[model samples]
Target: MHELAITQSIVEAVTQRLPDAQVTRVCLVIGKLSGVSVPSVEFCFGPTTEGTALAGAELQVEQTGGRVRCRHCGDEFPCDDLLAVCACGSVELEVIAGQELLIRSVEVRNHV
Candidate 1:
């Protein structure tokens, strides 16, 4: 699954940035429309992070709902999917949220 590759990238990025840090947790923000599977990412996290600074780190995730702004009617509303139509019968929706894949935080311990 692509989540394996994504997980690898996350580990690599974190370790590269904080080579000396003792990482205890990694907080992620995955959007509902991001096309990334949370379960698959969880499965890959351990394997991808093995031997890295992120090894043994907890993977904490926060999910966001999809929101769109109707281009034709200027209406802001919640959208569940790409094909969602606005109440104004407009298909011209500009995605304002819920397409994010972010690393919000990395909790680490100070060197003793």
Candidate 2:
């Protein structure tokens, strides 16, 4: 799964930042339109970190609301359940959120 690759990248990045530290948790901000499933990520994290310092580490995903701006009305509103539509009944819209995929933060314990 792609989540495995994503997790591998996270492990690589964390290790790079703290070579002698043990990762305790990973906080990820995943938008609804990011196309990455939280369950899938969690499912792959265990296997991906099996032999890495992140083994047994917790993976936390924070979901954010999707937002879209109406090009015709210039109004911004939640678009979680809508399809590029504005409250003013305009179809011309641009997605402003719900497509983010990034690591927010990593918690680690330094090795003495």
Candidate 3:
């Protein structure tokens, strides 16, 4: 699965940002439309983080619903599906969020 690659990337990025620190936890903001599976990420995290600073790090995920802004009426609403349509019967919808895969924070212990 691509989650392996994604997890590896996460570990690399976090370690690069906090070099010499041991990562204790990782908080991620995942959106409904992000197309990334939480279970898959969780499954791949340990293996991907092996032998790295992120080893044994706990993953905390915060899932967000899909939010879209209607271009025709400038209305913002939560969409359950990716139909790209607004409730006002407009096909012009701009995704304001819900496709995000962001690292909110990282808890790390400083190296001696």
Clashes (backbone N, CA, C under 3 Å), per candidate, total 0, 0, 0
The most accurate candidate by lDDT is 1
Better of 1 and 3 by TM-score: 1
- Global lDDT of model 2: 0.82
The global C-alpha lDDT for each of the candidates, from Candidate 1 onward, is 0.90, 0.82, 0.88
What lDDT tens digits, residue by residue, belong to model 1 across residues 1-112? 8999888888888988988998999999999889999999999998888888888999998988999999999999887688888888989999999999989999998776
What residue runs in model 3 are displaced by over 4 Å at the alpha carbon? Answer: 110-112
lDDT of 2 by residue, 41-112 (tens): 888888888878888889999988888889998898887754555768899878889988888998887656
Displacement of the residue 79 alpha carbon in candidate 1, Å: 1.6
Residue 34's lDDT within candidate 2 is: 73
Instruction: Give candidate 1's error at residue 20 in angstroms.
Output: 1.3
State the lDDT of candidate 3 residue by residue for 1-112, as single tens digits.
8878888899889988988888999999989888899899989988888899899999999989998889899999887578767777998888888898989999987666
Clash total of candidate 3 = 0
Which parts of model 1 have CA positions greater than 4 angstroms off? none
- The candidate that achieves the highest TM-score relative to the unseen native structure: 1
Q: Specify the poorest-scoring 10-residue window by lDDT in model 3.
A: 79-88
lDDT sort, best first:
1, 3, 2
